[model samples]
Target: MPARFMQMQEVADELSVSVSQVYHMVRSGELPAIKVGGRGQWRIERARLEDYIERKYTETADWVRENPLIGREDEIDPSD
Candidate 1:
């Protein structure tokens, strides 16, 4: 069975981002997480992580719709 909760590192790995980025998300309340154990380690619920991913997908879709590339694709800098 899959884990119901995941460590910050696991969350970062799942999101393909750095652990520090995950920490920042949690600290900024952009991602839902909880402090656990005496050492105050952070753990995010699996459901919450899934929800966050879904929300990001929706946000990205909206952004794409609002910011159409159209003829401006050629104007984009390849090296930025």
Candidate 2:
């Protein structure tokens, strides 16, 4: 197989999350990772990370649509 793997720290930094969060992701199987050689080390696929990011974006967009920004009609007035 190819070296399509990223360290937990790198992934954590990229996601702006704590290492424990990344560990939780690996533990919960949210991120595609593998523990190899009887070690607790975790490695995630870059593509899987990208997919997770895309999913988050989609979810955030849906949430924004459901809960529109807080503003008023006067915020867009013509006769100001």
Candidate 3:
């Protein structure tokens, strides 16, 4: 069976970000997770992680739609 939950480190590796960044994400309510174990460890549900990624994608698309880049082709030089 697939994993139902993942540790903070696992989430960090999956996202290619620092473990501390994952911790801050959890703390900021950006990602969904639960604190388990006697030492107050974090466990993120695999589905929730996927949902977070999807949400970020949507947010980025919206931002790009709102703020498009403009360029002038004539402003470039052929030789640097």
TM-scores for candidates 1 onward, in order = 0.89, 0.76, 0.86
Q: Write the per-residue lDDT of candidate 3 for residues 1-80, one digit (tens) a residue.
A: 97999999999999999999999999999998999989999999999999999999999999978876567566668784
Local distance difference test values of all predictions, in order: 0.95, 0.85, 0.94
Give the candidates in order of TM-score, highest first.
Answer: 1, 3, 2
Residue pairs in collision within model 1: none
Q: Name the candidate, 1 or 3, with the larger TM-score value.
A: 1
| Candidate closer to the true structure by TM-score (higher is better), 1 or 2 | 1
Q: Candidate 3, TM-score vs. the true structure?
A: 0.86
Name the best candidate (by TM-score).
1
TM-score: model 1 vs. ground truth: 0.89
lDDT of 1 by residue, 1-80 (tens): 89999999999899989999999999999999999999999999999999999999999999989999999988999885
Clashes of 3: 0
Residue 15's lDDT within candidate 1 is 91
Instruction: For model 1, state the Cα shift of residue 35 in Å.
Output: 0.2
Each candidate's root-mean-square deviation in Å?
Answer: 2.3, 6.9, 5.2
